[model samples]
Target: MTEIVFTPIGTVHSPFSDPRDMPIQPVGARGVRGTIELDPACAAGLQDLAGFSRIIVLYHFHRSNGYSLEVVPFLDKTPRGVFATRAPRRPNAIGISMLRLIAVDGATLTVEDVDILDGTPVLDIKPYVPAFDAYPDERAGWLTTTSGAARTMRSDDRFC
Candidate 1:
């Protein structure tokens, strides 16, 4: 395997300090607001981003300290491979979430529906294009059954 490196483009600011109390998915976090403080050098990247109602934030689960190939996810009772679930404990502690864009003020972006913990390191941001990103009929395998619980689900410290 080859080693790859990335610097944080920004830090995510959210109300949840403890991962245990945070929403497990954007659906559960609807209307929950937050902010992203980007480095000034990356301010130019914010241009025209306001046109997007939502953006996919690729971030590092900086607080995740370990990796496990198999573990029980929050919504399941049985163990599953890490790749099969969105559990933060993975080979790479990378996280992605689609958050509503409330406003973009230079390098600072006010957002909503955030599920990530506060101070998470943002790897990149991309506009969410419904035509290119949505998949209404896609099969989710184990996720299909699990995602149904999202409406009432909130994360606990099982992964943390």
Candidate 2:
């Protein structure tokens, strides 16, 4: 396989200073607030972003140390393949969260519903359009069994 590299355009800041204290997913992070500080060169890309109610942030889980083919995710007790869950200990340490846009000033974005760790490297941001991104009925695989438990779920160092 060929190697690839990515340079972060910004960092995510949230109350989650420790990986163990962060929300595992957006469903568990409602009302939490955070911000993104983009590099000056990426400031211009923030244009027209304020109009979107929600934005998808693609970031790197810089704190995650290694990969595991199988993991016991937050919601379930059984171990499953890494790709089957949103566990952070993947071959590629990346994370994505959909946050509500509160405001944007230059390249700084104040957002809510944050699930990522503080100082996480941001790879990209995309506006979340309901028309294009939302689906009324979707199958969640094994996650279906623990869907109701997510409201209080938070991440831990197991995957970090």
Candidates in order: C-alpha RMSD to true structure? 0.8, 0.9
Model 2 lDDT tens row, 24-125 = 889789999999999989999999999999999999989888899999999999999999988998999988888999999988999999988888999999
Write out the backbone clash pairs for model 2: none
Model 2: which ten-residue window has the lowest total lDDT? 151-160
Cα lDDT, all candidates: 0.93, 0.91
Instruction: Supply candidate 1's per-residue lDDT for 65.
Output: 84
Candidate 1, residue 132: lDDT? 100
Superposition TM-score, candidate 2 onto the true structure: 0.97
Which candidate should be chosen as best, given lDDT against the real structure?
Answer: 1
- Stretches of candidate 1 off by over 4 Å are none
lDDT of model 2 at residue 35?
95
The per-prediction tally of clashing pairs is: 0, 0
